[model samples]
Target: MKIRSVLSAAVLAVAATFTSAQAFAQDTFTLKMAETWGPNFPIFGDTTKNFAKSVETMSNGRLKIRIDSANKHKAPLGVFDMVKAGQYDMGHSASYYWKGKVPETLFFTSMPFGMNAMEQYAWFYHGGGMELMQEVYGAHNMLSFPGGNTGVQMGGWFREEIKSLDDLKGLKMRIPGFAGEVFAEVGVNPTNIAPGELYTALERNTIDAVEWVGPALDLRLGFQQIADYYYTGWHEPATELQFLINKKVWEKLPADLKEILRVAMRTASYDMLVLSQHANAEAWANIKKDYPNVQIKQFPQDIFQAMYDANKKLLKEASASNEQAARIVKSQQDYLAQSRAYTDISERAYLNTMGTVE
Candidate 1:
């Protein structure tokens, strides 16, 4: 009789364990996401929309993400703060935007002479980028992930051609991130402006130049019509947007759901980069065909040299003050040096060869 009682209790405990596991797997979650972009804002907006839909679909309705854009929240630049304070469960914005709050955050976006999209994404995943990013944001009670990538960005739309470094002095330009600091080092007055206001800012002389994404996005703002000189890209190569999640909120998610969110974020990010390439290519062709007046210009060698030197100087200054920043810089420089070697030999060499042949 005693043996029978022991066996019955054992079976009941196993049943209870199975039931708990089932309940855990079936748990439902609906997370709220706040974005920096306004509603229906092209590729950037599509990233968030795709991610939300993917999360729900992949999890079979166990997880859902509801997104609110800048217009809804009335805080275009408040994503980090809102998510950190738990006002929002997650956020979609660029890491560099949080430079004012955490200096190390800027490195996660893109540097002036940084790696290209392929190389940078490798660094983020295979390299130490993810660990470094977590260390920086961990103190702030948030977890940040690579949300999307805009590959290489154009220099800016300038009202006048930058004939020399002198032309850069006192120039009010709507530029952001670490590149802005580099521009400031070269005597340009760097300012940040929301996307919706860029066209008016330039037309009214509120800003002298604007460095937006690329042909795809810049064309939408009508910069080609007003700014006659469309400079080629040099500042932001592999500009990466980030997804922010509150630490408490992240911890509350089950293991399987956490993995689902990660896969969804990564997939959406890669898709955005592909979309950027297609859209930029299409838009560039259109600009050449329809907007012949828009002249594509590259900065003179001397101007490029000056900005390059200034970028180095600014990086040195940044490293001197903060150990964390110093470590992050070293990691990126080390990785860049290693990977750029292969890139030059392979990608760069092939492109050069193809250009000469065709």
Candidate 2:
């Protein structure tokens, strides 16, 4: 009887230990995310959805991301502040959107006449861009990762043709970020208008031009109906959106879950670039076929030269003001020069050759 009681007690203790271990093994975590985009906002929205799905799948339900769009949060531009303050565990927005609050945040998004999508992605992964971006966001107790890319955005939708630098003078435009500053330097009056109000503003002649995303997103806003001229891109060759994670939230995540989040964000960012290319191609074809009144135009040589000079000057000023900004700018400039040289020989040469073939 004594031996049987001892064995029973030992077996009960082992079972309790096993149960505790199982519970720990099956522990789960859920992170709430706030996005700058409205509900079901095409490419931008799709990226976040993809990220959430990937995280859940990769973690086998151990980790989950619950996303709230601008409509739910009612604060499209408040992503950075909310994420930094721990109001949200994560956020999806452009880094430049917070430039007013943190000036160094401007450089994470594309600059005027900067690297293209491929070049910029390379820079982020291989050329110290991610480290520099983290340095900027770290001060705010957040971590920033590349959320997505818009590829090379169209310069803008203009009501009339831009003949020269003079055409930019006194031009009221809906442009944002560092690009807006560049335009302001070139004598344009740059204004910030909400995305929902862009069409009305243009239709009412409140703004002479609007610079939004590429064909994929711009078409949805019906800019073609109000604007006659669509200009080629120069300002934002690769506008990279950001994923913000609060440092405390990130630190609390288990190692495996952290890696899962990283991979999910990275993959989603690249996916958006490909998706943008595909969607833009289809949208451009539709616009050409349906919108006969729309004309595609490039800025004149003198205008491009002037804007280029203005961009360089602004960059210098930014770098001069902040030591970290100087390092980031120089890193990007150096990487771009090196990457572009090869791109000019390979992609550019091939495209130029193909242009004459047909």
Candidate 3:
């Protein structure tokens, strides 16, 4: 009887220990995220919300992401600082926005005449883009991942037709990032304006042109009614937004939770690209029907040639300044050259064939 009682006590203690351990493993965590976009701001905003939902679901409620849009944070462009300082655990914004603070960051976002969405994603995951991005962000105490891609952005809404390269001179435009620098090189005065004020600025003639995202997002700003010329894009061929996580916060997460967050972010990024395509197509169709005055135009050969040259010169200068920038630029140029060759022969060729048939 004494032996049986001792065995029973040992079994009870083991059961209690096991139960405690199981409860600890199921501990829940909630993270705060800051975004550059306004609340409910079309595709960009949706991406964050979708990511949050995905993380919650994949983690089975063990992890939750609370998002604060620009309105809540009151600092649209301060996402990087907020996340890095641990004011927010994560951030959603374009990496290029921090170029002034971190020059190497500019390479993570799209480049002028760079690879399109598909090729860039390939470079990111399969190639060394992710590793390079980490090297840039790791110093800031943050980890960066691709948040979303806007495929190829439209150039901008111009009030006047760009007949030649001369038209770009002295033109004040709301353009941002590396492309803005390229525009400046070509004699255009590039300025950064808040998205909320872009329409008013353009309408009031405070700005001569605005280079927002493509049709889906630009339509919301009513640019079609205000500006006639919707020029095609050469800059920001694949404007990829970023998901930035504070390194400490990320490290604190359990391995399972970490994977859930990573997968959620990646899935959300790809989803945004698909959503951009669908939404842009629908928005373009609507513009064609409702706004007949909005004419789609491409920059003339001379203007493109000059801007392309300017882009190369600017990239060369950027590379010369930093060794990392030089490596990133070379990697992109090399990948683009190789990828585009195959793309031209396959995707472009098929599209060209279809156009001829139709």
- Among all candidates shown, the one with the greatest TM-score: 2
Per-residue CA lDDT of model 2 for 305-333, tens digit only, reads 98999999999999887998899999999
TM-score of each: 0.91, 0.96, 0.94
Residue-level lDDT tens digits of model 1 in 28-86: 98889999988999999999998998899889999999999988999988999999999
Q: Give stretches of model 2 more than 4 Å off.
A: 1-12
The deviation in Å at residue 196 for candidate 1 is: 3.5
Native-to-model Cα distance after best TM-score fit, residue 323 in candidate 1, in Å = 0.6
> How many pairs in model 2 have backbone atoms within 3 A of each other, for residues 3 or more apart or on separate chains, i.e. clashes?
0
What are the lDDT scores of the predictions, listed in order? 0.92, 0.93, 0.93
Clashes of 3: 0
**For model 3, how does the per-residue alpha-carbon lDDT over 1-358 read when each residue is reduced to its tens digit?**
9999999999999999998998889989999999998899899999999899989988889999999998899998899999999999999999988988999999888989999999999999887999999999999999999999899999999999999878999999999777888899889999999778999999999999999889998998998988999999999899899999999999999999999999999999999999999999999999999999999999999888888999999999999979999999999999999999999999999999999984
- Among all windows of 10 consecutive residues in model 2, the one with the lowest summed lDDT is 22-31
Ranking by TM-score: 2, 3, 1
